[model samples]
Each structure stands twice: as structure tokens, then as C-alpha cells.
Target: MTLTIEGFDHRRVPVADGVSLNAAVGGSGSPVVLLHGFPQTHLMWRHVAADLAADHTVIAPDLRGYGASDKPADPDGRAYSKRTMAADVVALARALGHERFALAGHDRGALVALRAGLDHPDTVTHLASLDVLPTLDMWDVMRGASAAVGFHLYLMAQPPGLPEQMISASADAFFGSFLDGWANDPAAIPSDVRAEYLKASREAVPSIVADYRASASVDVEHDTADREAGNRLQMPVTVLQQDWGAALGYDAAALWEAWAADLEHTTVTSGHFMAEESPAAVVKALRALMAR
Candidate 1:
């Protein structure tokens, strides 16, 4: 019943609210669930997951709206909220026999992990977020042309239908833009892996847009509520970012400290895609966090 890298199997797990997720399981130690960034799949963790598999059971899943997972049409704008997605992770882990496990997310997945910490504190032992800010702080920091780096965030945050329609019109370009710009070294992403990412994202445009749209609205509400309540992540938290704030007009560490109680914030000089660009650094950071 144990899964390993050489013999890994991907399965579709059904969670509450009729959403099913594609999850890959491997390794055999302390459970560590991994969530990937936008326009990417669980595949984002391919390198980091292998390294962690040496001492931790790694569970990487395509979020509800991405990859090979079920993309149920969003009717009320509720489907793509991080809270709902966080619930999916919680349910998915429980179904896999992990009542409590460490959780880490990159990009969009990091927001999901933050929500998981807020909504299901007892279930997530530790939280790790790579290259992202909380939903509220993200929006708060956006202003004028300076926010051009995250143009997609503003575009996707618009009213649901338009964004999805436009993105679906040219899936390759839309997804490829982030893939190219976010990574410091595009060559680091193998051609085959890049192709696979574009293919998967092309098909999941609608669901992906909806997921981003939620962040501007419902996700913001949840984040604001937690912030106003002075709620901090109850578990140990680790944040690794590319020093975007200094270059783009904000303080990364200060922003993160507002949410995490016990935190280890490190600014990485590597590309935005830290996992692939600097897997060893990523592994070292995660290990240090896990040890704490």
C-alpha cells in the first residue's frame, strides 16, 4: 500500500461538495502535502518532492480547478475560493489516512495553505508558503503600472465570465507568459515539462480563471476577516520569497510577519520559480522548517 517515487500512482480523490482532485502520493515517513502555484500542477514539486521523499511522505495534488482534476463550473463564485480549496486539501489528506500533516504551497497553493492554517488549525501541523503574500496583502500592495509584474492577477480578478473567456481564447500564450516571466532561467524547465504545463493549463483555463477571480472577492473577505480578528497562523510557518517587495516597493518580511506567529522568512535571490530554479535551497529551507 506504500507508494514510492519509482512506483508512484496518481489517483482521483473525491472531496466534499462534489469536487474531485488529482493527487500523486509517494515516500513513507511524516506526511507532507504539497500544493503548487498558478498555471502549474502538482508537477511543480517534482524535484522538491523527490528530495523530501527521503524522510517524509509527500502528497502533491492538482488543486480542484487545475490539472487533471474535476473542473465543475463555477455558478456562485464560491467554488474557487481558497477556503473551499483548503477544505478539499483537508478532506483529501484525511481520506488518505493523514489526520494531521505538514502542508506547503507555492503561489496559489500557498494561499490555500494559509487558509488551511486559519480554517483547520488542528489538521495542519506546519505551513510553508513559497513566493506569495496573503490574499489581502497582495491586493493591498497593488497600485498603478508598478503592479505590472502581476498583471494577470488584476485581469483574472475581474468579473468571472470575461476573464475565463479571454484566457480560454489563447490558453498557450496566457499560461506561457507566467511560465516564461516567473522563472529566472527558462532553460531550467525542461522543454517536455514546459509543454506538459502548457497543455494542462490550456485545458483548465476556465477553472483557473475562476480560481483567481475568487481571490479578488470572496478570498479577500476571508483574509480580511482573519486579519481584523488578529488571527495568526497557530502552527510554525515558513516563507521563501524572491525579494519582490524591495524591487517592487514593499517589505516582504514585514508583510509575512503580520500573519505568521512562529515564522522563518528567507528572501531568496533566485528566480520566482524557486523550486525548480534552486531545488537545493528549497530543500534546505523545508528541512530546516520541518526540524523546527
Candidate 2:
């Protein structure tokens, strides 16, 4: 069975503390929440979500401050933290009558999914992460030549308003920059979809930067606390990463195991935008995770 974006019902659902989230939901069977990466909105999951909706109840939401979701100012950087974002998902699920569900996330969303599993393990039964390492390991692994693989990490981590202001100046180009740099074949992403990502990200510039900016500060602190507390994700985990080792000279699978105990990690031959670049692969991986 194939699902199309047109099949889903889109609505703004209230979550926590009077905050509301814009979500795209469809299909039936077990629920699976799809979370997208940075600089892209829930639109990133259009293809995969539709496919999964054929089998499972698929819920794709624009993270708290991105896409059409309310962009509450990140006063004190709390709104952008993964902990808060995870809570939004938890509340959104409960509101939708799903106290427990399968959760999958890519890029920034993957981080949120990770936090959700760790912080709220009883709620997330199965977890899938695409194209990212845990926050602390991701920060710790950069060394020498491999450092170039994630220069944006440092660029966005700068103190205060600089990164946010610079990115907001020409938000279209700033957000679209990853599309050009990360894809092995830029043509892999349909031009219309690419435009949609840039358009939504460009509009949500301040909140988007605040999301990345939190990764540099409080996110690190949270990851440190998790590490010290020895709270590894107890749920079944499936991680799909690009082969950064061959090009960047280090194994990514090893790094991921440090964070997840029951993990099945592998590298996809496609680009960083795995879901967009190769939807079939993403679908297969998710199907495997669902089976697990």
C-alpha cells in the first residue's frame, strides 16, 4: 500500500504548557512519529511518512519552533532544548491517544528522539535515528581532518547573537547551504521539496538558530548529565548513518554504541539526507525497526 501526502490530515494540536504543534497525521495500526532534521520542516518526511502511513499511523510534526509550529521566543534558550522538544512530542502523543508509540527522527529530530527514549523510555517503545550521533559523542569525536565534516557545529556554537544574526541575514541560502553540501547528488531531492524546506526554514530563522544554538550550550550540558548519570537508551535502537569513516577516517558505528545498548547501527551509502535521497532505503530500515 502506498500513501500520499494528500491522504493525511494536517492540524494544530495542543501539547504542553499551552504550546501547540502543527502535525501531519494519517494511516492506521501502530503509531510511528517521524521527526525531521535542522533547516528542514516536517516536509522532510513527506515521502517516508506517506509510505509508513500505509502500514502504521504516521504522525509528522514540525518541531516546536520550526515550520508552521508556533515560534515561541527561546527566552533563556529553554524552548530549543531537546528535553523541552521531547516533552512536546510526549504531550502531542498523549493528546492523540497514543501513550506509547514507535518514534523515529533524523538529524535534529534524531537527537530529540534520543532524548525522548532516554528521558521518557516508558513512552517510546522503539527508536530509530538517522544520520547523527549522540550530542556528546558527536562533539567529542571531531579531531584534525575529521573536524571539517561538521564545521557548522562550531559555526553555530559561537557565543550569542552572531551565528543567529548571520544565518538570518539570508536565511534561504543559510538553510539551503546544507542541501548543497550534504547531498551526494543534489538532484536527489525534488526541486519543489527543496524549495519548501528552504522557504519554511527561511521564515523560521530565529527559532531555527536558537535550536542549533542550544546544541552548543545547554544541549551539551544535558548530554554531559546523561553521560554522568549513565542513562543509555533502554529501548531497541536502529541508527543509519552515512559512511563518514571512509571519507572522514573514523568508524561511526562504534561511536553510536557508546550511547545505545541494544543498537543495530549501519552506514547508508546515500547522502546525509538519507530519507530524501533514498526513500526506499529509509522505508526498509524503518520496516526493520518496526519488526524489531
Candidate 3:
């Protein structure tokens, strides 16, 4: 059986025409939507969601083109762009009776949350991004040998057929490699959860590749346009990231300051999959962001 957040109720929320997100929602006071990263599902937010549900309405959903969410074909490439995915998130919240709420995301979801905060400032009251940089800055900073760490990014960024076919040929090995290598404590993600991630990713290879492909193309265009227009995240923002800058030769905080007026950036000791490996710290940071 698939594992779920203990007390949260699962439902399909229609965020767009013929597109419904599989969301696990619970708690009360204020709403906070949690987004998962690549090679994972909303289940990645299991621990954090349960704790936040104690005081906040936590909505954790499998992103469009991921997990159990509807995987619409990306014939136009715009289908999986962060702009479109951000709209899905806003629509999800409004459909759940929230006109304004805190938004948080890990990995790929972080990209979505950043876009949402930029595109719908009034709706996202607070924003938290776990372990990722905005699309444009991300591409800019990755260079030389350090760029090797993001080989998958370049691989998936290739035109449609090749990346999908390559990943699909050995889906488990491809997706499982990240789940194993990126975690500081592999045990943090138990066997069952790891299996779930691999299974979901294996089944959604094309859509997942499309999501990343968009990040390299259209997502970069959107962020570039926003930067040129001097558009920034209008809400309070909290960023928790590993000390990637120290090795990658970029000031993570300085880069983020360019986009957020109210910013709190911290370098976490946890690995890339911090949400699962360091839930207490993740929860603490999120609570602090919401309290701001």
C-alpha cells in the first residue's frame, strides 16, 4: 500500500481544465502549500506536513507532470513551464478556499513557488524555498567542473525524444541514483518511500523530462524577463540551502537578495534532500517564515 501523511485527507483538486492535482490536505489556522522536488512526490513532505498541520492548513501536492498528478502532454513546451505550474498552484489554493496563503517548495517545486511569488504576489503571503536557486541564477552560476554536478540538467534539457527515451530505458537506475546519492542519510528515506519515488518517476519519465526541459528553455526566459522588469518576490521570503555556494563559487545569499526585498537566507548542514533528512529544522524555518 502507498504511504500517506497520517492524518491528512487526500483528494484530486482540479487546478485547470482537465488537470487535477493529487493533494494531501490537513490542519486549520492558515493555509500553506508544500511542493516536492524531482525524483519524489508530495510524500517527500510527509513529516513536515504532519507537524505544520498542527497549526496550519498544510497542502502538499504532487506537482503537475509528477507522481499521481495529471501528466498533460507538453506539445507546446509551455505545458510544463514554471509559469503554467505556478498557475496550477494558485488555482489549487483558491479552489481549496484560500485567497491568500504561505507557499513553500523543495527542489523543482521551489522553482514553481518562486514563479508563483513573482506572478501572484498578493496571493502568496509568505514564501519559502528549500535547496534551489531561481532558474536564471541557477544557469548562470553553474560553470566549469562544478557544472558536472548538474549533468542531468543538461541531459534532460535536450530536445524531446532523446532525454525521454534515455531516461525511460533505465528509469529506476536513473531516478534511484539521485535518491541515493543526494541524501546525507539514506535511511531518512526508508525502503518503501524510495521505492515509491522510483516507481512514480519511472512511470512519468516523459512528463518529468518535459518539466526539466522547460526549466532550461521557457523558464529561463520568464525569469530573465522578470529580472529585466525589476520584478521581485513582493512577499517575505525565507531560503534554506546547502552550502553549495562555498564550493560552486557564488554567494547564495547575495544572489537571492537581488530578487527578494524581505529575505532570510541560511546555509543548512543537511544534504540536498533536507526536508526528509532534517524535518525538525525544515519545520522550524517554515514556522519562522510564516510568523514573519
Best of the candidates, TM-score: 3
Model 1 pairs in collision: none
Residue-wise C-alpha lDDT for candidate 3, range 224-277, written one tens digit per residue:
999999999979999999998878899999999999999999999998999999
CA RMSD, predictions in order: 2.5, 2.7, 0.6
Residue 180 local lDDT, model 1: 93
Looking at model 2, the pairs that clash are: none
What's the true lDDT of residue 259 in model 2? 82
User: What is the TM-score (0 to 1) of candidate 1?
Assistant: 0.96
Q: Best lDDT goes to which candidate?
A: 3
lDDT of 3: 0.95
- The window of 10 residues in a row where model 3 has the poorest summed lDDT is 1-10
- Using TM-score as the yardstick, the better of models 1 and 2 is 1
132-190, model 1: which lDDT tens digit per residue? 99988888888777888788988988886788788888889888988998888898787
Model 2 TM-score, all chains together? 0.94
TM-scores for every candidate against the unseen true structure: 0.96, 0.94, 0.99
Worst 10 residues of 1 by lDDT: 1-10
